[model samples]
Target: MKFAGIGVLNAARKTIARMLGNNEIAYESAKSQFWVVDAKGLITEGRENIDPDALPFARNLKEMDRQGLREGARLVEVLSVKVVIFLLNFDF
Candidate 1:
């Protein structure tokens, strides 16, 4: 399974980390994958000022555009993950 989250600081990334760490949802058993996108864009390498909790989920910049995206619709369209979790209050 693939999961994409829209917000990182507002408890979304932490919750997912806890779930994966505690094995609460069998994410490992199913080989689920997770990605997080904060206000700037997809969390990628060299993204300054990243919350410590969100560092583990960050991916290489080469895999995605590092310029950043502002809209949730664009994020969904580009990531193409099986599930998208919007943990923040988005205007969309």
Candidate 2:
């Protein structure tokens, strides 16, 4: 299963990171399962000005499908994500 988000929630990131670090969840198991899309697009490696909290989820672009780092509404359709949590409302 895969998950994607519009932005990284600091508290949520920390909690998930802790879960992975403590062996509650394996890193490899969570890699493709978690994703975040910021202003620059999907949180892939090489994206600049990445928040420290989001660093853990910065996956390699090649891991994604041919479309790669989709932005805004396109993310929903392209990734076929099942659930979307809107932490805040703002123009993408």
| TM-scores, one per candidate | 0.44, 0.49
Top candidate by TM-score: 2
**TM-score for candidate 1:** 0.44
- Model 1 spans > 4 angstroms off: 1-32, 65-74, 89-92
The residue-level lDDT of candidate 2 at 21 comes to 87
lDDT of candidates 1 onward, in order: 0.49, 0.51
Tens digits of per-residue lDDT for model 1 on 1-92? 12234333334444655766746454332223555666665555577766665566565565444434332224665477435444342333
RMSD of each: 8.5, 6.7
The candidate 2 region of ten consecutive residues with least summed lDDT is 82-91
